[model samples]
Target chain A: ALAAPALAQANPEVRWRFQSSFPRNLDVLFGTAERIASRVAALTDNRFRISVFPAGEIVPGLQVLDAVQAGTIEAGHTASYWYIGKEPGFAFFTCMPFGLNTRQLTAWLRHGGGNQLGDQLFADYSIQAFPAGDTGAQMGGWFRNEIRSQQDVQGLKFRISGLAGQVFQRMGAAPTLIAPADIYPALERGTIDATEFTGPHDDERLGFFRVARFYYAPGWFEPAARLHMMTNKRAYDALPDAYKAAIQVACAEADSEMTSRYDHLNPIALRRLVAAGAQLRFFPREMMQAAWTANEALMADLAGQNPRFRALWDSYRPYRNELFQWFRVSENSYDNFAFPAAAAAAR
Target chain B: ALAAPALAQANPEVRWRFQSSFPRNLDVLFGTAERIASRVAALTDNRFRISVFPAGEIVPGLQVLDAVQAGTIEAGHTASYWYIGKEPGFAFFTCMPFGLNTRQLTAWLRHGGGNQLGDQLFADYSIQAFPAGDTGAQMGGWFRNEIRSQQDVQGLKFRISGLAGQVFQRMGAAPTLIAPADIYPALERGTIDATEFTGPHDDERLGFFRVARFYYAPGWFEPAARLHMMTNKRAYDALPDAYKAAIQVACAEADSEMTSRYDHLNPIALRRLVAAGAQLRFFPREMMQAAWTANEALMADLAGQNPRFRALWDSYRPYRNELFQWFRVSENSYDNFAFPAAAAAAR
Candidate 1:
């Protein structure tokens, strides 16, 4: 029950600019930023408000980290892997090719050793990072043609990013990086034969189905892509403890809510894509096996070349392996048996 | 950044007694209540504080809802299915036999109309409920002997609860409901041949592995058990909007953190169990298939008898079906391909 207290000093109102890496149209991804901002404001009784800006408004999407580092904005929401060019270890914070799924990644970051390792790395850039959202297990990509074997991957031009790009390269395919806005045009103009983006909801909005008739899954490249909210270190440190806790709470809420939104909307959008004649196909077994091989080799190479990458990899790989073991016993077993039965019953 | 401001009107200070359904020894489950209380206090700058009381402190574990409904406590943290005697529909809010996993359940509750349905049913008891924690995809019960086929279940005496009890009963097994504290002794004394509790972390604490060497999984009976933080409707409504928002933010944080903690701790505990000579086994295919049949039949029977249960079932079943379809293409596909490879490499 509420009891009136002696008058106290008012907490100062604070406002922040939060730049999002995703465009305004990709609501599920970009909207996570809005949700965090509003929830923070609500929890703080409007004393702390954040104004969200989509890509290219304040700065380009890919430059969010730089903006946050330079205090161009007080905070920014973007995936950590996009800055892999800066450090190979950055990819682990987002997603790796065939890395941990959404829940595993969340556990590692929140409970396992991931957050400490992440903060240590992010501190170098003068930023404090928090996981804000996740796009659970992405679709492989939309393909102009069905891939039947490893030979189908040879010399095929693809638009992909992160370590997955390197895996593709090892498979003798030409991998190119393209911004989300440009992916559709590249596919449409035959510049790229295949491209991976977010899952059904955002993919449908970009009209990838109209351009590429074959929608392939599952996206081994970025199994579960996590978005991060990075605040300028000085700005973050200056906040009162209550406001700091509010930010953490807001980010956790957004992280959970965004994944649920994707899980709910992806099914509906997928149905629409199928109705519109987008053929759904699984990546061929041979292709998957070959990609797995390439991923293993590439990870080995990176670990040998960069000690920092090796440090993170040593911790990440084992944690991931343990998670894989546990999931096999629990999640994978139940899902493998029950899901197919449910599908057959629905049919 | 924070700045000084002139003194303003004092906000009301509110306090609530938050009762937990779990004993203090079961830290992971009961600890969620403490986390929520502290986070809410932190977010509200100590203006709103909730003091958590463990099971049997203010009232017995199973009487949480009754306490909240009778206004004996302002709030409670417990499982909805624990009160299934009040309404079968309450089972859906917690979990069901062969039901949705944690992520799917979270999606349904947050985004796929489940929250509204849950609130509508909870309104009858003058309670407002929010999901506070989840033990993600529990392991199957520890068994004294290996189950190799459907025939093995025919005369088994099992300790289980909720709809799962009925399913076991239909399988020709003698099913009994026992309190958590009593399960270890019951199994040790040969009163029950087997029992399903939460999972490895909690199971190890209860020393189930000592009594039963054959640890079978996955727990189809209760895939993901969600704990609820229920507030008395009058008390909840009377709170200032900011405090209400604080409660919500606190609950969401607790929900995410608990599952992450379980995912992290279970693996360590499982490894410890295995080292101590526990033989981990998968439920035989024949046993799983039979239990699935029993689950379906029992669900149909409940829906046929209760309109409210039917209403929630109609919605939950379809949402689950759609989620299954999506997971089949995304999570299941990736896991099936990758987990085995990871396992082989680890070996």
Candidate 2:
């Protein structure tokens, strides 16, 4: 092992270009990729390098995953849900509405059967994926008006992406998939009635609060949103073992860092949003009920369509059910009574 | 707010019993007052309640941070650094060898701060504190190790806690820390060379880890660790605002679980010291010298004293004169080359 260092000492420089799904504006997500690129260069003694391109620089922001899939780029950073159009099952790889929280998701992916399952799923796409970042559960979307009942969503247009769009569509609302850059204009032009980005902090930073006054609670659509570093299968396959581990370790590091940034900043951002007159509202029971029904039906349809989805769902849903049962016995009971009153009163 | 029947109706009935610090055997440390009992009960519309007790009854194996902190037990969580006794800087809140991981400690206290931060910190503690618990930085503890060259750490006995311990003590030989119940036997049996208990994790688990692992991390002391809750503090504080936000919200949940339990656990056990096998070693010169003499010294020392710690060091570290300049450039460059070696090879 010691001689390994001496043997590797004489390697030439390798450089690759990478793109990000997020703009530099959303620091952590974008920063994670930047950090990995940074750490890689540092750890390799300057022998390997990655130059990152933020959203929209090399290709359209939303096209990063495709770029990696098409081998247009060697690697890229993105969220799986972004490509749900490619396959609804992809949503499970990124996040699930009202699904597992961060730790549970990580456990499933790392220690549980998730990683192997995920790689198998991505095999057809000719890409390899790693769990790089998580946003925990997110805040619900931002809306221009207070949603008093399910009727409020009857014909609303929302800038939501991935499988969640199907859920909204089921509620009789139209789901519009728009890139982050196009969101502000669309919402401003009344093209969409609502949009869910992240928590108050990112929303405020993007000035969504300026246009939308009603901020919903419990980002049920993304109970735990994960980001991935998708690499072209061929390109990725070409690297030495150490580089792969570096990517894995670096991705884990970034995953940890990104969540930390969100945890630290979200509180302040929520406070700021509230102070700025952003009215926070929990989804109405009727809405939650309706969404749940739609979500269940969508999943059923998905399972019927793909064997992979069926297999993954068989493993995934049961775990979620178990977690829910446990949390219901403890987490929910406590949170339901405590947070609403406490959080509201705190302000 | 009081007239909102919907809110009251939504509250559930919950009671959860949390255990910690003490062995199921050592009742006081583990059983004392079931910290989150009232809060868990309150959160669940009174349908849920938790009665916390010592570790033996539920999980006598090791600390229950993740089980409870992740809401596994509703609450069995405990002190932050009892594990740190294993890792260095891990003792920042729970306890440290030489110093504190304090403020950076708390900043990293939640999901966003650092890897060790957040609910997972308590996940090991066995409960979810969520903003409900915290402990300030802690004192470095008694160690069996003596000071000498870095090599002296080789074969020395230690019973430290957390990740830092692994990084530091692991570099050489003989870094170990066991639970309170096991510590006495190990020490009496000469199984451990050194140990660290929280000023409290040990007190409750009882002095063996501390008694045997006497020597502490130099300069780092705690490196400023921040202790916190090992429960659903969010759940607990979710009660009426009166108790929720009024709580300090600073105790770094895991350490809170650790401290109270250590205090509770440490009292009853009798220890028969093992002879000869244990030789206390202070961190050797090269290690301490490396920390003090390298940029780490300037950074750690400045962080220790500064309120901002380099405007919280996140920003400043990158900006400081040539401090990380090489890694800033060369490190990332090299790592990008070398880091992907494994991923590429696997493909």
For this target, which candidate reaches the highest DockQ against the unseen true structure?
A: 1
Residue pairs of candidate 1 with colliding backbone atoms:
none
**What is the lDDT for A45 in model 2?**
39
Off by over 4 Å in 2: A1-5, A8-11, A327-347, B1-347
Each candidate's DockQ: 0.64, 0.03
C-alpha lDDT of all candidate models, in order: 0.90, 0.56
Question: Where does candidate 1 stray beyond 4 Å?
Answer: A1-10, B1-10
**Model 2: what TM-score?**
0.56
10 residues in a row with least lDDT, candidate 2 chain A: A1-10
Model 2, span B108-209: residue lDDT tens: 443324434434444443334433322222223444445557675567676655544544543565666565566767766767755554433333345444
Candidate of highest lDDT = 1
